[model samples]
Target: MIHDVAIVGAGMAGASLAAAIGPRARVLLLEAEDMPGRHATGRSAAFWSETYGGPAVQPLTTASGPALRDGGYLTPLGSLHVGRAEDDARIERLLADFAGSGVELSRVDPAAHIPGLRPEWVRGVREPSCAYIDVAALHADYLAAAKAAGAEIRTDAAVTGAGRRDGVWHLETRAGLFSARLLVDAAGAWADEVAKLAGVAPIGITPYRRTMVQLRTDPPAPEGLPHVVDIAGNFYFKPEAGGRLWLTPHDESPSAACDIAPEEWDVAVAIDRLEKVVDWRVEAVERRWAGLRSFAPDRAPVYGFDPKTPGFFWCAGQGGFGIQTAPAASAMAAALLLGEGGVPEGLDAERYGAGRFPAMR
Candidate 1:
């Protein structure tokens, strides 16, 4: 049997796309793991920060806010961007850049936002619009909705090869052979590899490893602490349940496509940075994990049909904003894929298309 579209991953990107397009097309959601969201989606400590993805990505993320908020997938955690006095210019530029972007922003004393804030952290920018994302619930909901819409999801279906034959995408997967009219490269970190398997030119999408550690602090993190991020891009941390703090060094080490392990050095760096930022004492490192955030050469998510290869579509290179941008990204991708002209408002749909990458040609 032939499906209308075959999505190569079952993570947030693929799942969201499936959820959006499943009603309009027969979708086959494929995952190499025994279950969906075993990679980045499963490990995301995501927050819908309007400034997190920079200017190009903020549109999609901002556009997604309504759906995520309406679905009750977001909680008002707020965001604090802290920096040294010397970094005032950067902070001002940030405030200026997003002045009227619909993302509420204001300057506040670091001490007010973070308990026991360091003296050097003199500059602070508060974004009240940012909120923590319920990633697990969103992923599950997307998969469930997709399935309910008649999309077939097959776990452990790693595609070994793909080729176009007789106007159909023939795929050889571990589960079995499958055919579809269009193939979406949503394999996350393995997207470039999947493109190669389909005899299409690789788009140079690279996966970077990011580490997160859960710390049981001596004083126990405050329940009302906002998600704190360093303006210099050194670290970020937010309070978790059970008096734990989820922390990251904001390290983006280059890595290949695979199950990633957190390096001890990275964990140490996170602790070191946290120590300088706040007065919280780490009684124990309750847990630590790492995941890959893939990106294209331009660092924007690639969408739209491939210019070089027909029947091949791109929904990859989401980097770290995949979950936060899923709602609108999926809507935009589905509209483009379905030949519908109704793209989401305020989303610069052309910037994310595959045609922008001359390297892929």
Candidate 2:
């Protein structure tokens, strides 16, 4: 098969990139699993908030707002941050830092709003702009848009090797061999390994494990409930589709690149934190799971061609913000690979490009 661009991994990053370049170029999207988003993408907390990541990632989140709203991928779920008395300063800093970023937040005593929440254990900051994302629908929409624009997608087509030959890149996958003018690495946790196969220098991408547990409760949760995070981010809980609540300890332990599973210790930690904040009693744990969040040395995404490897491009190191930044990140990746003058209106490539990590080069 011959294509203009061959993309590895079919998560948000790869799928969105294929969608962006679909009209202008022939794209081949390859996924290792039987279905796309089988790993971290499928296990996301699925919330969109500009204040989640720091200033560096705020631009991408801001740029994606329009698309998220217009595409009907967001539901107004709001968000709250609760801290103990000692965390008042951190709460203040969070509010002050994100004020200019369009995050509307206010401080309040826990007793004023959350009667069940222990007053001695909590102080609260609320942001009305936070919302829940329809992750499955959003991913499907991107795939549909890419297919509609004439891009080819193949599942279980894991790329085993990639190399330049006769001024073109040859990608060997489980299904078959593909030739392309350019190759893109969007393999998430395995990004560095993919780069090694393509003869590109490793970029120090590390995958961290995060676990979440679902608990069932009586009385059901109120509709339109906001997502809540502890001031220390030790734990968070959000209402799910049914009467259950999805909770996490916000744990980010260093992990090997693989299909991660939740640890008993981590689950215990989450339960302990949840018990300290709210008065709700957990009847039972419905389920538990874990996923990997990959990060580069600087904790920023890398989007550009490899300096030493011709016809090889990078679009990795997204961490947990992959879904939120997909739109702009994909556009930026495609534009840079095509040698376009600059990134799209809202995104600046200088901060996100591979050049920022000279040590990687």
Candidate 3:
């Protein structure tokens, strides 16, 4: 049977888009794993900060804020970007770049907020709107809503090959063959491979590994401590429950598209960086993990259809901001796919359009 649209990944990107499409179209979500969201979505150190994804992505993040807040998936966890005196220029540039972008940023003394902060880390910029996200709950809700809205989901359906004939896509998956009028590639790290299998030009969507570690610290991470990030983009950490701290070195190691694991070198680097930023003693390395973040050549999300391939749509390359921007991105992608709704207001549709990529054009 032919589905109206078949998305090749049931992670946040695919699930949210499926939910947004609702019953307006017959949608099918194909998962490569035993269940959905086994990769990036499930492993995200989830946070929703308007400035987290840079200026190009700020609009979508801002637009998605309301939906997440209304759904009770967000809790206050302000972000503090701190740095040494020499990094003040980065702070000013950040404020200048996003001056009119609706992301709130203000100067603050680093020591006033992050206890035991090194004195050399003098300048700081605070983004009070940043908050933690309930990623698991959000992903699960999208999947459930999509299912309830009449969209079908099949797990262990890895697309081994894809071909288009007579204006219809025929996908051969591990589970079985499926036919769809329109094929959507929300395959996360495997997006480019899926495009290639469909005889479409690959968009250079590269996956990068990011490392995270939870530590038991001495003098314990203080209660109500803001998420502290370095202005140089080297590290970020925040207080977790039981007086522990969740930290990452902001490592973006280029990697293959597969199940990933944290490297000891990266973990050591995180600890080294954390030591320089604060006086906290590392009592134990409680937990460590890694996840993949895929990006297009330009880093902004890719939406819209292939310029040269009919019935083929591109909805991958969301990178690390996929969760925070899911609501807006999915809504916009759904509107583009089904032509059933208007693009979210103030969204720079062209920036996110597939046509923007020279390869797609």
Candidate 4:
């Protein structure tokens, strides 16, 4: 059977976009793993921060807030961007950057917000708009929405080959053969490979590994501990359940597309950074893991169709902000994929268009 759209990788991007496009078209979601979101989506820090992907991505995140809150998928969990006296200029610049971007940010005392903060870390900015996302529930809801719309979901379907013949995408997957009018490359880290298989030029989407370490600290983390990020981009930590802290060195190690393990050096760097940030003692390293964040050379999400490849859509390069921006991003992607109506007002679709890439241009 030929589907109107067949999305590669059933992660957040693909699933949410499928749900957005399902009602109007016959959609098929193809997953390589036994389940969807087994990678980045599942391993996400699970917080929605407007400042996360920089000013360029703030619009999308801000626009998604209302829907997430309405769906009851967002819980009130604020964020704190902290720094030392030397980082005052950078901290001020942060507020200046998003001055009129609709994101609510205010300066505050770091020590008052983050308990046990070292004296050196004196500056703080509160982004009250930030919150925790129920990732698992959000993903499940999108899948359910797509399913309810009659979109077919196929797991364990690793695509081996892909080609367009007579305007239909003929795909060879581990699960079986499939045909679709429009093929979407949402394979996360493997997006380029999927494009190549479909006879499209590679867009230089590089995959980078990020590490996360869960620590059981001497002073159990306070329940209200905000997601604390460093102004220097060194590290960030937030309180997890049971008085545990989830920390990351903010390391972005260039890596190949595959299941990744946390590098011991990264874990050590995280611990060292954490110790300097707070006075709490880390009693145990409860858990450590890593996930790949793929990005286009420009670091902006790539949406819309390929310039030279017909019936092929590019829906990868989300990096770490995919889930937070999913609600709006998927809607934007759906508008483009469908070729009619439903475009979110004020969003510059051309900025995220696939044609923006230098290679394509």
Candidate 5:
């Protein structure tokens, strides 16, 4: 049986898109792993911060707030951007750029907010509207909803080959063969590969490694501590349960698509950077893991159908904002998939279209 749409990946992007499109189409959400979200979606330190994706992505993030809250996926948490006294220019630029962006940002004394802030780190911006995303819950809900909507979800069904004949896509996977009218490339870091399998030009959606380490600290990380981030992208940290802190060096080393593991050097760099920001002592490193954050050349997400490929859709390059922007992004993607009627009310669709990529064009 030929499905209306078959989405590759089954991570946040594919799962959410399935939930949105299943009501209108016969959908298939496919995953290579035995379970969905074992890649980037499962390993994200997700927070709904308007400042996280810069100006281009702020609109999508902002528009998604209501839906996320309604779904019980967002938990209130302030996002603090701190920097040294010498980094005052960074703070000024952030304030000026987002002055009217509706992010609820404000200047504040860094020391007052963080217990062990360094003396020289006096400048800061706080996004009071930011909140932590329950990624696991969100992913599960999207998958479940898609299933409820009559979308077929298949795990361990890795796509080995794809082709089109007589206006239909024939996909060969480890599990079995499936046919569809449209193929959506939502395969996180492997999206480009999926396109290649379908004889579509690759969009240069490169993946980068992001490392996160959980550390046991002295004085115990405050449960109420805001999500602390360095404006210059050196480091970010927030409290985890059991007095541990989830820390990252904000590292973005380029890598190929695969199961990623944290580099020892990157882990050490995170600890070092965190030490400079906070006076807390790292008693021990409890755990360290890494995930791939894929991006297009422009560092913005790519949505919409491929300009040249007849039945292929581009839904990759979400970077780190996939979870935060999932609600609106999926809605926009669904509208694009179903023609032009339900375009999420306020989102500008042209910015993320596949036509923007010279290679795809």
Candidate 6:
């Protein structure tokens, strides 16, 4: 069947894109896995901090705040960053860099909030505007909206090849062949591979491995506990749905595209570091898993059409901020594909466009 847009990979990006494009365009959302969000989107820390990404990316985060808050996906959880005395300068610089970005933050004595944490651990800052996102709910909401908008979503439909024919895209999949006027590549880690299949130059998108472990705590549920992150980003822990806590060593090792597994060494490193920063004890590990976070060479998201390819659009390299930035980024992708006037109001697409990485070509 031929659609107006054939979206590859039904992760948060593709799902949200399908929703944003709506009934205005005939959209076909495809996923390779049996379920959607089986990759990076499913494995996120589920945070929505406005000051999370670089300066250029902050606008998208800011613009996405309303949807995240009003859509019933966000809950205030706050975020805290601890650094040793030696790391004071970097921590201060980070705070200064994000001064007026709307992330409410302040420097506090670490020992006061964290009983056993030493004074040295309090050298950094805290961001009160940070919140935990209901990732599953967010993705599900987008999927439901997309479906209601007349977008067709297909799972277990992997695109093996994509080519241009008569000014349209011919996508070959195990399920069947489909055609579309435009092709949207939201394949996450396989984004570069998808571009290659479509005769577009690979954008040097590299996927990095990140591991997380969920641990059972003694009691109290740690209800008001905020996400604690090392100033150096060595490790981070946030309270989970129940009394459990999700922890990670924040490893960003380069890896090939595949189902990522947790390395014992990485898990050990997280445990060792986490123990030093908190008074609580990790009784047992309930689960351990890993996922791939793909990035462009510049570490920012890539959203727009390929300069060389007429109808092929690129919406990849969201890195770890895919969940939080999905709303705005998807809107940006739809706007660019439809060639609409200047990205709804506050978003600056020029910064995140695929053309930003000329060196990658």
lDDT of 4 by residue, 51-158 (tens): 998887888888898899999999888999999999989998999999998888998998998778899888999998788899999999999999999999999999
> Model 2: runs farther than 4 Å from truth?
218-220
Over 1-361, each residue of candidate 1 has an lDDT whose tens digit, in order, gives: 9999999999999999999999999999999999999999999987889899787798998999999999999999998999998888889889878877888888899898787887888889888888989999999999999999999999999999999998999999999999999999999999999999999988899999999999999788887889999888899999888878999999999998999999999999999999998877888988999999999998989998999898999999999999999999999999999897778988888899888887765
Estimated TM-score per prediction?
0.98, 0.95, 0.99, 0.98, 0.98, 0.96
Instruction: Please estimate how well model 5 matches the true structure, expressed as its whole-model Cα lDDT.
Output: 0.91
Better of 3 and 6 by TM-score: 3
Off by over 4 Å in 5: none
Every model: Cα RMSD to truth: 0.9, 1.7, 0.8, 0.9, 1.0, 1.6
For model 4, name the residue pairs that clash: none
Assess the local accuracy of residue 154 in candidate 6 as a C-alpha lDDT between 0 and 100. 88
Model 2 alpha-carbon miss at residue 65, Å: 0.9
Candidate 1, overall lDDT? 0.92
Model 4 TM-score?
0.98
Off by over 4 Å in 4: none
- Worst lDDT run of 10 residues, candidate 2, spans 217-226
Per-residue alpha-carbon lDDT of candidate 3 for residues 12-122, written as tens digits (9 for 90 to 100): 999999999967989989999999999999999888889887998999999999999999999999999998989978988889989988788999997999889888999
Worst 10 residues of 6 by lDDT: 111-120
Q: After superposition, how far is residue 342 of candidate 4 from its true place, in Å?
A: 1.6
Please report, as a residue range, the 10-residue window in candidate 3 with the lowest summed lDDT: 352-361
Residues 1-361, model 5: lDDT tens digits: 9999999999999999999988889999889999999999999987788888788888889889999999888888898999887888898888887878777888899888889887888888888888889999999999999999999999999999999999899999998999999999999999999899999999899999999999999878987789999988899998877878999999999999999999999999999998888899999999999999999999999999999989899999999999999999999999998895688867999999999977777
Each prediction's whole-model lDDT (CA): 0.92, 0.85, 0.93, 0.92, 0.91, 0.85
How good is model 3 by TM-score? 0.99
TM-score for model 1?
0.98
Q: How many clashes does the backbone of model 6 have?
A: 0
